[model samples]
Target: MAARNWKKGSFTGLHGLESALGLFYTRHMFRLAHFSDIHLGPLPAISYRELASKRITGYINWQRNRRLNLDHGIIDRITDDMLAAAPHHIALTGDLVNLALREEIERARLWLESLGPGEKVSVVPGNHDAYVPGALARCRRAWADYMTGDDGRAPTGRTAFPYLRVRDRVALIGVSSARATAPFMASGHFSKAQAKRLGALLDRTAAGGLFRVVMIHHPPVRGATHAAKRLYGIGRFQKIIRKHGAELILHGHTHKPTVHRIEGQNGMSVPVVGVAAAGQALGSAKPPAHYNLFEIEGEPGAWQIRFSRRGITDPHGEIGEVSGALLSPGK
Candidate 1:
């Protein structure tokens, strides 16, 4: 099976391919599993010097609040289920650490490795990953490949925002909204430069008939989060999508499952979805840890995407489907 030769007057991945010398042809179906805000815990020991800056606040927050809500036991169960289901690809939106500490970032990388190789997994930093001024540099050094665009075309080894990855009939656009904020603040932002570049890339990618999915850390819709932790440029982000158009948007940060509708082209509505923290323990304050499994099957124009939201409800519980929705309406 030469796998459909792309060299012939050939075809785009948009079409079904015949393999084994044309004995059979199968339409391609892409399955993507999405989860975010892992906040892998058991934070490293802190020092007085380390707490000299913004980290002191984060350190205290983790010790008092986050550590109790985040449970690795729950996370382990969810990860086991994800691996068992084995989607074709996985996207992690961020918060893979507690304090953006070097040890935390490196540990998160190792956890990502256990999930799969860089090709199978994608990551975008969360606010916690950028909790301090220079922490992003360390994250860039550690998780460069996961953040790289398809074909290694993204800007250097640094974690460049809004890189593009084209797979099958889908274009996964990775964007960074993670930013270091003052103590008691958890927010995200997208620069004007990044917005311009993203608009161009969205137009180009959508022209190729790929289902554009915007990967971001914070929800782009207005009123999606508390004022202190919201995405700074919600209006700008909405304008870009309304102008350029994306079929779907995925984000993390709220740790609550949500499906917000936004305007798309020609009166159609685009779906912006947010998943609860993948490692959070079951509690009254927030939704339980869950990951979304999207079943994407169809050709370029007649695509169908179905969502299955799965979660781990308790420490001794097994993962199960919590709900389902048609990501693409009218079909």
Candidate 2:
């Protein structure tokens, strides 16, 4: 990820403050656990037909490098830690599978079920999820329950992107950037049509005085990823944020922990955060497996957020908080 050029608010150890404030806001606090980029492995057997196109390159890459670096056991540990924290809701950004194989999709669905029910969790797809022309349709069919909005309809057909799910005082908005690309290319696309819908959703949610959180698989800011894996139409996405604003934005794709700020309404700078891959092993070249817990409280226009980054930081394979910060809204 590139260095952030805009001003960023400082992060503090707000856990102490949270302890003090808990007396009054315990019931109001919404704990949201976010993790992404599973790329679940032990890739199932593939027929010659399965490896006909993009799968061939992905298969070769996984067998050569990904299988060794990504450990399902580490993912299990992370999930255990996340569950122990007892977040009110869990948000998974994307890349739940590698090759988007039929078996991989099915296995990922089971993994999702283990986390919790559809009402307690939300998801968005990544480039790998839609690795081929038909892979995304398969994922939609298998994981529709997880991606459906609060209205109880699965995200299917044309009105898919920018689905809405309201939980308590927060409005969780999911947008898809997942799409199939040429071999050796790992890119995502956010259409203008999605942006138009997102703008409307943001407006409606904002009017309801709910804490709006936008979830996407790829980072929406510029220079966040390599050209080969960038999110096209990011400008349109940013335009939506600039106009209607959101309380926070969560994403995963660069496979690294990053914080960037996007200009929001009335000069408010919304926090755009990305977590390291949940399946990445400790001591790997990239940041180790990790998850983020966000503590949000307070009503509209007076929100307080505390962010804690937890992950395996040692050789013992134990997961702990790597960093903490007090995030001020509109900073």
Candidate 3:
């Protein structure tokens, strides 16, 4: 693909992507697919014990509206479309289950296997995955393979907050912002300790001349969500980015396709992108389910990123590329 001449602008038609496919086939580019918020259902039956905690509110919400708003079939379609694109690796930011129930967690494991092997996919937890105090522990055990780092454990070998997996030329760093919160709230927390470890990882990856891609569940950008749903310690997260640069940042809490920029080293700007929920049904209040394909090429300092957003755009349930752009690193 002669992407060198393609200026940073919106892709006007399918022709641009169609023509580039020929060149993409010949070149060895690193293609990464990112999607989140699966919220798989029909939420397995829950008992009174499960409903005694915050799950009570979530269970009510799922019954009243989420059941209709989320469709597992839509997620199936999205995954099929993404796999057809043939990305080298997949990053799932989180919320694979609805209420973090044991059955739901186990079901999510099967769904992950269908996508690809653990080596080809990386994952991080979301607020819903940690809906209650003990839910996250169960998720850790169930999804251990996908969440483990290159060393076969979390980065610290003690906590699972920050994990690293280096693919070809890209380093996938998984961070968790998922935590249990009070009723009527859906916020996430990022502790100073995790931020410290993240900074070191970014530095180490950058030194190794690897393209660093930080994957987290909640958007690190301020004001990205409502007050009750915002990520706590977002400032600390931003501080790390401003000090140590990263090529890209992927997140998925907002359940809306969004693009935000955070300041990076030497005044460069890092792209913080979020995709809509993978299970969002057509005609739902939010945008239909979508996933992002990022083609990363070139070397460490002169890297190039071409990203396309694909998902259901009509009531027919057909998936298509909604938008795309040739992104510049420091823009």
Every model's TM-score: 0.89, 0.91, 0.90
| Candidate 1 wrongly placed segments (more than 4 Å) | 1-26, 154-159, 313-315, 329-331
TM-score of 1: 0.89
In the predicted model 1, the residue pairs found to clash are: none
Cα deviation of 253 in candidate 1 (Å)?
0.3
Better of 1 and 2 by TM-score: 2
| Comparing 1 and 3 on lDDT, the stronger one | 3
- Name the better of 1 and 3 by TM-score: 3
For model 2, residues 1-331, the per-residue Cα lDDT tens digits are 0112321223225645544454222337788999999998889989999999999999999988899899889999999999999888999999999999999999999999999998889999999999999989899889998899877777776578789999888899999999999998988889988999999999999999999999999999999999999999989889889999999999999999999999998888999999999989866689999999999887888899999999997888889999999875675
Q: Name the 10 consecutive residues with the lowest summed lDDT in model 1.
A: 1-10
Off by over 4 Å in 3: 1-28, 154-158
Global Cα lDDT for candidate 3: 0.89
Clashes of each: 0, 0, 0
The residue pairs found clashing in candidate 3 are none
Of 2 and 3, the candidate ahead on TM-score is 2
Best by lDDT: 2
Q: Which run of 10 residues does model 3 get worst, by summed lDDT?
A: 1-10
Give candidate 2 misplaced runs (Cα > 4 Å).
1-27
